[model samples]
Target: MSPVVVLVGPPGAGKTTVARRIATRLGLTFRDTDLDVEELTGTSVQDIFVEHGEQHFRALEEQAVATALAEHDGVLALGGGAVLSDASRALLREHRVVFLDTGMAAAVARVGLNGNRPLLLGNVRSQMKGLMDHRRPLYAEVARHTVLTDDLDAAGVVDEVLRLIEQDRA
Candidate 1:
């Protein structure tokens, strides 16, 4: 099954929210690999990171993205770091992928310092900065489209994604 669209971005980039809205507007289903991983392990993402470590979580995320990319037929939102996997990046090249780009201030404000995010542990802004800096290229390398979400609301991002999907259909 081929996904209608796949969304990739750094954490706090509004991927999930925008995907849900796009799915609703398009009358398609919404699937998030992060939630899939949680269901697969019967635990929260934070717990997985805390208990099994980032490598383990990344493995699960990679598998989740692989399965979703191969099997899902709707709007799919991947975990922020999913593109870090070469296999996932290659698979993403076969589909319509959108990267929701955001600025550091917006990402930090959206994510916050005291969230359950596993990557933003001690110093949220600094860690998020590092994460975004390191992963931006990976996101760009696999994405077919990139929408800056720093100024737009979720609806605005959804509008852009819908436009991208329509362009793909055309």
Candidate 2:
């Protein structure tokens, strides 16, 4: 099976929050690859990165994303950097992908330079800016629909995604 809704975006774009709400509204299950990776390792995403390193964490993330895409028939949320994998991006193309586009300012504000984020540990703003800028094209490449989450609350983003799903169905 494949996901009915797949969320792709940078950190703080509300992929997890928006995907969960959309799943509930659609009466479907919600799954996040980050959570899946954590469950697999019995640790947090940050811990995985800290312990085994980014490359290791990314390898695990790619596998988790692959499995979830093949097996899940629900709303799926990808880790921020999941699209970095060419394999993952290719897999995403066959699904209903939505890009939660967010500006650097809004993203930084939402994330708040949290310690929980492994990649943004050094300088959250600059790191986030770079990450977002680098990933924007990848996200757009895989997503059939795009919603700028910078100006919208979770509910508003959810509404837009729902509308896109509905429109896609029609």
- CA lDDT, candidate 1, residue 21: 91
**Candidate 1: segments with Cα more than 4 A from true spot:** none
TM-score (all chains, Cα) for each model: 0.98, 0.98
For residues 1-170, write the lDDT of model 2, one tens digit per residue: 88999999998999999999999999999999999999988999998888889999999999999999999999999999999999999999999999999998999999986998888888889999889789999999999999999889999999999999999999
**Candidate 2 ranges with C-alpha deviation above 4 Å:** none
Query: lDDT of each prediction vs. the true structure?
Result: 0.93, 0.94
Decoy 1 TM-score against native = 0.98
Worst 10 residues of 2 by lDDT: 113-122
Query: Which number leads on lDDT?
Result: 2
Where's the lowest-lDDT run of ten residues in candidate 1?
111-120
